[model samples]
Target chain A: MLHEPATPVGKDLAATYKMRLGVLMFLFYSLFYAGFVAINLLNPLLMEVTILPGLNLATVYGFALILVALIEALAYDLFCRRKEQTLNNTQNTQGEGN
Target chain B: MTIIIFLFFVLLVIGLSLYLGKKAKTSSGYYAAGGKIHWGVNGIAFAGDYLSAASFLGICGMIATVGYDGFLYSIGYLAGWIVALFVVAEPLKRLGKYTFTDAIDSKYNSRGIKLAAAISTLVVSVCYLIPQMVGAGVLVEPLLGIPHGWGVVMVGAIVITIVATAGMTSTTYVQFLKGGLLILFSTVLVVAVCVRGLTTQPDQGGNVPYYEYTTLAAVNESGQIKVSDAGWQVVELQDIESAKLTFAKLAKDGKETWWLVSEKDGAVELHETQSVVTTRDGQRLINGAPASQDNQLRQVSNIEKLRGASDASTGSVSPIELLAAVSDKDTQINLWKEAALTDKDGGKVTIYYQKVTPGNQVMRPGLKFKVQGTPLERADFLSLMLALFLGTAALPHILIRYYTVPNPASARKSTIVAIAAIGFFYILTLFMGLGAMINGVLNPADSNMAAPLLARSFGNILFAVISAIAFATVLGTVSGLIVAASGAVAHDLLDRFLNLRMDDHQKVRAGKISAFVIGGLAIVLGILYKGMNVTFLVGLAFAVAASANLPSIVMLLFWKKTTAKGITASIIMGIVSSLVLILLSPDLFKLYGLDPATAPIPLSNPGIVSIPLSFCTLVVVSLLTGEKAKALKLAAQQ
Candidate 1:
């Protein structure tokens, strides 16, 4: 025997989630582009101390770039999820009123 | 003993490969280690796969010889990973099957996308593989004292065997091993550098003496010259006093110790006490005055022979007094003219003294070639930088690694881990390069040998370890590239394009055969392109990947308007444009010094132009053909 599932606000929430994700994705790319330009300008000074044995500023910066990218990607994912939840709650309230 | 250690390392690697090969029973297992690898393990392997021979050897050599500009490559390489993590990693993992083609063709059942992607994969993989093979050849030269061609052959055979036997399963494990060993040993070397401080010594032998030009004249009592217009001559100095001196003195462990020294004038001087007894001029003082015409000037025998007579009364030579004696510019022990060439024939040739000074532009890029009235030759340089920046994410071998992990989360974590490991190793390379430069062990003929030779300075034991690890690093990366190429050939081209209905066993067999064939081709290309930098070849691979595959993948995922025809056109355009541009670029002319006049293209990398073009082609074509595509999709669903 199949059990009936509880009603969940679905299509409206999905649409809002997609829109919010699209906007966050735009911001993510924008931030990375800004960081890239900033780091590119500072590369010369970083290279100066790179002559020392064992410490390389370029490699350190590479690690920093990866860390920043990870944070941006995760934040985008979370923002999309939260926006989807908010839209789902709004759709549920509207359905009850109707 | 070195050979034994090397053999032991090789045996250990082979054993690990066999163990992993046994576990690769299924097609998925063979292709991506059953997609069960931990992010931490895969991440380190990613570091292993990315570092390659270029990061470990070429960067160090470049830094030692070229100075700051060499480190620029390392910066560009690291920055590219940002593009990989932020834009490519999670989405690529979430997309389709074994290859990047799978992802693009998922939305549209388009044969055109598959064909274009497979061809692009082959081109990029072959290009990327060449440098790893070349690195293998370079490593074998010093390790076995064999010819470079033999080294290429050996690496090709080994990588093919590994790829053919187990594919990605073995490839991943090998890369993980290499990544761990590289980081661990490099850290040990760095600690050694910190522990052993720089020092100096007098009477240090075995160093080749440097020669400097000095003019000398012989004068009689009437001031007549004995010889005029002499050329350069080699002279041995009993002692040299400099305000700044960089040299390596031997330490207690037999490793060379590097030092930088500076001394003030009047604090040091060379006091020659030997009196010359020549046939032309009997017994004359030679320490305080310049040599007279008849007085023969000979190099002093020892530091004792250069001791000042006035300082003899003081009994012991103080460091300050020793410095003061050598710093005296007024005292001249000997004066001799350098040798010169004179042509008596109609050719009219004579050796003349001229000062040489390197220009400021020598350190900057674009000095060798320039585009007049433009800032740093925008087209060629920008193309190269763009290729480097975008290429890592697009690379087939790097892309396929994402599939080796379980899910998108693992792919993301692995990339982060890779970034950390790779970043740390690159940091070590800078020090290793500077250390090699000051160690006085850098080979003038080859910059690629800098890291290995630097290790050699510490002892043969360290040298053997580093060289073996380097050899293993090449093997791991090459195996990974071959596996990716083989998968594209067997899975995408043979199965999907040809519509071959084969059992899983047959597919694996075909992939193995393809791996062997591609591995052989990689060897030939590597041998042909010996002495060129490996990093540049990798950049070319990236350019092709970004231009050809990236646009199609991104469009299919995001654009609802994308059509099969649009993707096909985009892939074909991306592949054709980037490859054609690279083949005709000035780099081809400069690398082999081919005539640029005949070259059809001007830019080396097409990413700056071709990437945007591909995206636009997809969009415009999709919009125009959207209704026709809509009907086709509707009918297929029905």
Candidate 2:
């Protein structure tokens, strides 16, 4: 019946930054994802509409999702590294001042 | 020659494992590769670890057999990596030492957390193992020309050795090789598919039983349609405009089979194609004769018409052009759909008949998923997608890979790499599946062989190499699962409960023993769950993982009031509820020789219910026990 976090996990300097970015990305992606499922459920005929030569909305939207995931991953990684670098620099300056 | 190549790959993996076995002498080295793997190598290894037989064989097979619904599985699977990347990857690396259980239990030195998380890991790992084992069996049939049962046993034996000897080190390398080759060869195959282009009639199986379908000129008035010649009777025409098939009885032959009923311009045409049948006396018959090599079910995904292409071929068409050709209104793909019935002699007859489907229909959502069906079907689709998305972050095997990297940053970097690799591979699945569909390489008896068979359709050497890589795909995933399970047993459960002082060597010995046992169990389950769709089976595993482990992991990280009891309770509840719902599902009901319609549970997947239940249970239990746990914690510290 232990109640506390087994580790001093929240004390990490980057914990808050990581959590905020992660949650924001998660919510944003999930919202975009909902439209895919919603179309398949509500009006599936909409998926059959041929937007590109032989490709319909279903195929187009599906490919877009996979493509978006890779773009988002690369974006997330880039953003995290930049923030980490800034944090490291700030910590060094503070350490020298102290 | 194929055997030589296959054996070479097998021996290479084994030799590598035995060589690396020296490093696994210690527990840390055995469990997490001594935390020395480079991030770049680990990234491809992550792809190797994540893209199991389910991704390579199952999704491709699904797409080939049922059309676009298989692509839906790929989409959902890739979507899951996002959750893994954004939420769990870095924190899991920061906290975990060996197993995923280690991460969750780091804050609480409580026996409850150890027991619960360990059990959850074992459950999810085994559930995941079944599909890979099943996929192994399916691929082995075409790979080594062995029976399905032997294939499962062979995989179990090899993977057990992999896990028991070098543990994580060899497993990681095996996965990296598999991931790299799978993507490379798949790209080559897609290129081959594009260059070969689409053909209307793919006589790849040496023209086996190519029955010329006779179109009957039928004059119909009102609801009932009749034919004066050959004693053919259509009881009801039933909207030939939209229907893919219609029923017809031939009075002359009295054969029980469906006729291809479609509307042409303003007239209705009835056509007959070759059928393979099996009688109650165990007679295998094709076109009402004893089935032989010359008259058996051929490589079947044949296109009836190659619209927008010249000379019945669209040679060297680009990917887009190929898709466009298939989507043409005049384009038709001939697929074999099987059905069973009792004949006039009161004996059973299984019939595989031809059904001509439009290319546009093949690329849409309604083939397998029934998107236009009732609310239940829609709910099932949503449930599957939800489970897939949430489940990736919670999988014990995937979580353990986070520990293989040097630091949290490496873990983050490797995860993005995995995303790039896996996402790219899944995109290739759409082409491979469609390629198999048009090129005539699909095996109707087992859809799991679609990807391998697609290679076989083009070249023998290509098939052999692809099959070996696919076999290694199973080896890699099974290796990871066994490692995770062994860690749960040895590091989390046995170490805590035994309370016996054991060194690294002794602990490693315990882990190897558990890996062997879990591998044996996986083989048995793989054999039992034969004929079921591998992707669907993997989907069920995802549901179980998302329900059982995810709520606990997410709650532990975010909810400060999460008690040891609450975590334990949630894990147990999630496991129990999901298993119970699955057991009562229509699919399992059919498995038990009962009518699927009679199953108590309406939903096919348990995630939508069991996941929320797990979360609610955690919150309520944590609330109720917060003060009690606080007092106990203070007392223990004092």
Candidate 3:
């Protein structure tokens, strides 16, 4: 079983990169969610406006938020996969050189 | 027939449990499924574990009754998973062994951390268990014609068996099966709702509605009946339940009495009933008559006309059209009004009222949250939203799932999959809730029945399928909670804290024993909290989690200066403060038959307050004991 963490510097590099990306996505998504809540609290009547022929602002905004979440998840995965691959290549070359 | 189907589902679950039990011999196998669960299956299992009775029943009911407010929970819950994915998942997988306590205690061998984390896990688990058990009990009465307590015990027994026998292995499979089934059936229901199209009135199949609408502002007290609005003097209260109800007894102002008196669009209107029946066989009766074998319940539909539509009915509108139709300000919908009315002697009687609201108003947030409500109400709304947003990553059951996957990468992948599955299911809830709302299927007595009842409107077969899935939802969640709780007891308290030198076999045995005890405690509490809304209870569980667990997890991972003393102090402070705030909140006061105004805490959700306090406690304590931080480095090296 793996006892300690693998290569403190390597883990830290990935962790820092991932945390920055994650925090950005989290904050962005949170702001989007909070916007909806703010509308409800400040000017609920705005929700009644027709955003589409059959859809209102509230319904449109709600579904839009769900879409954003799915998009963000996909983005995070792709970016992290790339970062991990780059780290692996550097470590492999270093091992071969040694 | 419902009993047979329900039994079949239950038996299938148990069979899977026993089959999986064979693989879970070791403590790791029993507690964390040997840390070998495939990311895809574990991802679905995460959904199964997270999407408890609250997601399935409570959200649907809330949407059915209140429209858009219910879906807010879905947004918050799914949002929380983002935090888990980005923040906790990989680190938790990398660090933790048997339990969440293992992760927090990775840097320190402190007894205080073990005790505090274990106690917090227990508290959160028990609080979470109540809702699932309550939801199970709610399902039994309608599905099996049994009392609520039997349903609670039934679920408790099944979950205990699942935990005690196979532990995480059985739990993962059970969760996977139910999770897939829940999404599948919910999709089927949503499709049915779409295909049925938008209609002003549900097709009654020529049968008349049981109770008539009445405009008479009549008072029924003991044997005296008075219609003050019509200037009618007090008369003998007619026993409508026993005797045949006649128009003559209810007539005033030369108008025959309408059976239902409704307040719609700020105007009180009278409505007439088409049919009423009384049954003696304990079989469910629709509008005073016993239901047919296949057609058991009457479908509820919106009574008011659709905005800009030619007539009272639209032949068949698409899903998008349905949303548009309801969003039209000209559209009128009948929203349920349930209030607890106390009589002169302080006896509480729940009165069911139907408020006909405009579509514009129904589709907004103020219905339950109330912008115009008291300051306490607004605070409660903000607090609940805060709790749901922060609580998802903090839940004991949810956090434990991270330990099931083998590696950090797998953990992250599984979380992404869970988000996809859970997010899709929540979107479906909007349609299901609306389907129930407009169909006239809501049981005013219990809104939690909205989803299953909506399924019944289509056919008894669909009803049985949905109810069984709901029952499975409860089982999957309760078992996950028990496993987490048991892990805390055996790994953290017994072995780590008390210095019990148990081998692998003995450790697994200890977990099973604790599972049994916790399951029993859950059953009793579930019975005690019967009839409460499952989703509301879940919100409280989330508040406790965010307040007590999240700070410790987040600070330990990111804050380099964090000491063992800080983590322990923060957890204790968070748990005690949040629990006390919740107990003294207006919601609890109301539950205890006291006026809500009597509660000491103004805000019901403590996350808004307690979470920050916990973070501050940790930071301050860590600064004071910075020298001890060197110990964490040594422990990490070992």
TM-score of every prediction relative to native: 0.70, 0.90, 0.87
lDDT of 2 by residue, B2-89 (tens): 8887888889888898898887778778888877777778889999988898889988988887778889988988999888888888
Clashes of 3: 18
Q: i-RMS values of the candidates, in order?
A: 14.1, 6.3, 6.0
Q: Score the docking of each candidate (DockQ).
A: 0.07, 0.34, 0.32
Model 3 chain A: worst 10 consecutive residues (lDDT sum):
A1-10
Question: What TM-score is obtained for chain B in each of the predicted models?
Answer: 0.74, 0.91, 0.87
Stronger candidate by DockQ (1 vs 2): 2
| Models ranked on lDDT | 2, 3, 1
Off by over 4 Å in 1: A1-98, B194-373, B376-379, B595-600, B630-638
User: What number of clashing residue pairs does each candidate have, in the order they appear?
Assistant: 18, 3, 18
* A5: Cα error in model 1, Å: 28
The TM-score leader among the candidates is 2
Off by more than 4 A, model 3: A1-13, A89-98, B204-212, B216-301, B308-311, B342-348, B372-376, B627-638
Error of 2 at B313 (Å): 2.1
Give the higher-lDDT candidate: 1 or 2. Answer: 2
